[model samples]
Target: MIPSLDWLLEQADRKLKKEMDPDVIAITRAVITELAAEGLPVGVAQAFRTKQEQDALYAIGRTRPGKIVTYAKGGASNHNFGVAVDVFVYADGGKRAEFLAPPDPRLKQIVAAMKRYHMQWGGDWGSFPDYPHFQLYDAVNGQPKPLLGPRYPGRPLFAGAERMDRTLIRLIQKRLRLPLTGQFDWKLTQFIEQFQRQHRLAADGVVGPVTWRHLFGFQR
Candidate 1:
């Protein structure tokens, strides 16, 4: 049988409860409780990270030391926003809990449990397979949008020139050196398409994740 949440936390060294978003912390607690009920007592390995810490982690195996553990740098990761968490399944009376890759049974169970809480599993990512990671997601267009706050929509800002009259239009105009008309008309769409082509992104004229990342000087 599994132990109580307090007991489980006592068995671990890190209590990242204070470092996570309130909703994310609640969801994580629920997941942990449910996992324990099912005889799979998992331990929290990581939670929030400051931008400086994230930058340090990003430097691993590239500049500083250690192996490559993460792809995001500084402000690019959900961990920096207290929306992501990593977990590990403990064994031998909570004495040992190692990070396991895919094809591991415990990882599979954790993934399923996280999904029940409407969380996105990092193991499901196509480019980076992180079996021990999970985060809050807002469903949009059949895709899981990470909770990136209001300032960062975490999804498409504007697509297909639909919202043609907004402040973003003025920003785009200023960015492209066009007349500051504050209109997302066909001219702006054509300019964005050209920019997308130059940047090797899909020329859909929609300010999606890739486009926004590039426009805001984020690493792809």
Candidate 2:
């Protein structure tokens, strides 16, 4: 017997609410709803993970006894930033969780649902395909990218500054989907202003701690 849609959705919601970013939560919920409507026993296997949890998973193949499960270490995975999730299908009368690979018709359906939300699927990865993984995509490349925590400097970053932290500038540029030039240029400032307006922050074209938090999807 297949799992009831309510049971699957309840499980998914519980996991997703643990630490998932709002955008990730929304997309994952939509995917689960769509697949479950089709009679697929879709469920979330993993959601946002702390750095310690990520490190433990990383050690599974290297130091622990298990097959290699992931390539990212602590702070390197999208999961560490609440942007990624691993989903599974219920089988054996909803008692067994199954990860589907390519050529599986149900896997195809799940992937389609994810794509509807502009999600990036690990199954589509060229190397080390992870059939159970999906993530929010970067706007610039439409690919999964790790979201680092806010690495704020002491002062605000603004255009026309004599000197700036190139690394932080690049990170902001990446988040804003601008050219990753690592320079505080006028164009980048404009984009920052736009983002601030969209998020209801001050449209001052300055990147401060608050702006940084918003840019990286952190709770204020």
Clashes of each: 0, 0
TM-score of each: 0.58, 0.62
Instruction: Report the number of the highest-lDDT candidate.
Output: 2
Clashes of 2: 0
**Superposed Cα deviation of residue 19, candidate 1 (Å):** 4.0
Itemize residue pairs with steric clashes in candidate 1. Answer: none
Lowest-lDDT window of 10 residues in candidate 2? 138-147
Give the local distance difference test score of model 2.
Answer: 0.80
* C-alpha positional error of residue 133 in candidate 2 after TM-score superposition, expressed in Å: 0.8
Model 1 Cα displacement at 90 (Å)?
A: 1.2
lDDT of residue 104 for candidate 1: 84
Residue 8, candidate 1: Cα error in Å is 1.2
